[model samples]
Structures are given as structure tokens and as C-alpha cells.
Target: MIKLQHIYKIYEDEHAKHDALNDINLEILEGECVLLRGHSGSGKSTLLSLIAGILKPTKGLLEVDGVSLSKVPDDAATLFRREHIGNIFQKYNLIEDLTVLDNIITPLIPTDLSYSDVLKLADEALEIANISHKKYNLAKKLSGGEQQRCAIARAIVNKPKIILADEPSANLDLNLTMEFIEEMKKLKSHNKTIIIASHDDLLFQSKIFTKIIVLDKGKISDIN
Candidate 1:
């Protein structure tokens, strides 16, 4: 579950203030697959970051799974993100030299799980992302699709409740993008709350999305 009430995200510097999001009020129920469709600078990414606990709203409340992220300290937010959020960025944020398996397990390094347990989770995630064969390959050596699979594996390895993907298909081909849509469908079947921010037409046309929200400038322009 995610809720945002009168949320405002403003970036202010010495000379000006830019509003990334303004007066956003939204609530996403559990297990819902939602699409955030907008052009560049439409506040889609900002909303995802706020829900993922990576950015605190400058005004109003933000709650994810009942936790008030806007009021928490940075460390607490980080912990909450690790525990409940899976973020897939547009640019695959993998360590260049690390192997795919190592990268997948990186998020688990901070937990108290034993080495074997960590490996178990990583292997399961790799299987789900269909990147098990490339598990030992270096991140820098993987192809675009392979790298995308690696990123997905890493994000879901924690088994997070809410999956936030920002422009996930930006680098993939049509076939790979279709594969991603299927993957998202699988996750939805597993009852995960999925939110994706992208302008991809394929996603908008897909049947998996339960709700489609279009943002204009810094506000919700339409919801379907």
C-alpha cells in the first residue's frame, strides 16, 4: 500500500525553486500494478523516489505500507527502503567489475542472513529474472538485455513488497521489453505492488497494468 497526501517536492537553491511534484494525493492498494506515464520532467520519477524513501517530500505526508517516510531520519528511510522497496533504475546501477551473482547478493550483505541463505535468495532471484546462466559473468561484460536482467535480479532478490521501476525499458529492445512485461505480470500474480514510471507505449497497451496515471507538469492530469 502507498499513500501520498498533498505532497510537494520542491528543490530550492540560491536563486530559484523548482517544484518537481505539487499537491499530489494518491493511494495505491496492495497488489495493484500501476503505470506512471508522462514525458520528461513530468514528476513521475520524483513520485517514485518519494515512495521509495529516497527523497523526503518538502510538504505533506507520504506513507508506504503504513510507515510515514516523510518524518523518518535518513538512516531509517534507508532501512525501510532496504526492507520493503525494490528500485529498478533506468540506467542499470551495477558495479562494473562485480559478477552477476555477486551483484544480486549485494543487497543482502547488510542483513544477518548467513552466506548460504544469501546465496539461496540470489539464486532464486536469478532464476526468476532468467539470468542464472550468466550469474558468474562480470557485469561489464553482459549485453544490454543481460544487464537489464541482472538489474531485475538484484532488485527482487530482497523479495520486497513494493517494486518501483523507473524507465526500466529505456535500454531494451522490443523483444526484451516484452519479456519485461511478462516478468512484471508474474510479479503481479505473486501479489507484489508494482509501480513503473515510463513513457513506453508497450506498457500502456499491456493488459497487466491495473491502473494508469498520467502526470502533467507537476500534477496528476488523468487517472484511468
Candidate 2:
């Protein structure tokens, strides 16, 4: 479902050129759950962003869900991401002023979905994320785990073909982490591709991933 070939990402500043990703090549299939393990500055997040089309690769070819992201125009890329990708971040990224239901409905705003249809989608997403009880709560009022679940609901509300999570279990305790993983695993039943970038050892120990890619020094150092 996703492929990257000889990907290189360079950041230029007034005095230095930083290589965030270098000579990386990888492929992830549909309905696969892949874990990316790396320390800080190791380019794991860079790889995810590249696949998500939030950051353009300085050089390389990237294809996601059969679309060549490297060749897509900016406007098309934006639309492609919105239509096909769902991103969950360590920070949750919820809108502070919106209620839980509102945040979940945010992504569908640009679509032609009727209000009732959007609400139905949001309700189903909240139920799937197990955040239905908090639907009326303001995003800022929820606890960390609750907030993260809300973020997940928001991310998957559109039923994107790909799910990208960056440090999704970072803030949760063991139980919550397991809960989150279980929720993520359920997506596989629907044939959604899942990629998680995390340094958490528990994820590696879970034996749930189809593959694990370890990144070091901006390159893929190991795969298992």
C-alpha cells in the first residue's frame, strides 16, 4: 500500500544542511501493521511525514495507495492525504474549543456528507474508539488517555485507507497502552494499513506487527 525508494530528505538552514532521512527504501502492504522503532533524531517521524505527504522528499519516489505522491501536485496531495490517510500524533492535535463529537466531525466538513450522515459517522467512530460517553465533553476537559482516544476517533472518522500513528502510546500507562493497541489492531479486520512510529518496547514485544523496521542515523538499519 506504500512504497518508498531511495528517499532522501534534507533540511537547509543559513549555516548547515541537515539530512533527516537518507537512502531509505521500504514497502508496506495493505492490511499490514508495521512498527517503526527509533530514537530521537533517527528520522522515523520524517519517514512517516514523507509517506503522509506533509513533507516532500528532497529526492525519491513515494507511492501510497497506488498514487505517486512524489508526482502529485500540491493541491492534489492535500486532497489525497485528506481522502486516504488518517494521522494520530503524540500530541493528540485536537481542537481545544471543539467538543469531542465536533473534533471527530472536523475532517468530514469538506465532504458532501449531510449533517445527519456526518453525525452518524462521528457517532460510529466514537463508539469504535470507545469514547462515545465523552462525546459531549470539550476536548480540553478530557484526561490524557481520553483525549488521545478522541484523537483516534477523529483520525479514523473518515475511514481512511491508511492510518499513521506517531508515538501513540507514549502518554498512556500499560493498561491504556494495551487498550489503544487493541483498538488499533481491530482496524486490521477492515483491511486498513497501519504504521506506527514509536520507541516503546512493549509494541515490539506484542508480536502483533507483521513487520518491524528500525531506523538509525536517518537510514533503515534493521528489519524483522
Work out the TM-score per prediction: 0.97, 0.95
Question: For each candidate, what is the lDDT?
Answer: 0.93, 0.90
Question: What are the root-mean-square deviations of the candidates from the true structure over C-alphas?
Answer: 1.1, 1.3
Residue 107 displacement in candidate 2 (angstroms): 1.0
Error of 1 at 61 (Å): 1.2
Candidate 2 lDDT by residue in tens digits, 5-54: 99999999999999999999999999999999988999988899989988
User: What is candidate 1's lDDT per residue for 121-205, written digit by digit as tens?
Assistant: 9999999889999999999999888898899899899999999999999888899899889889888987999999989998889
Clashing pairs in 1: none
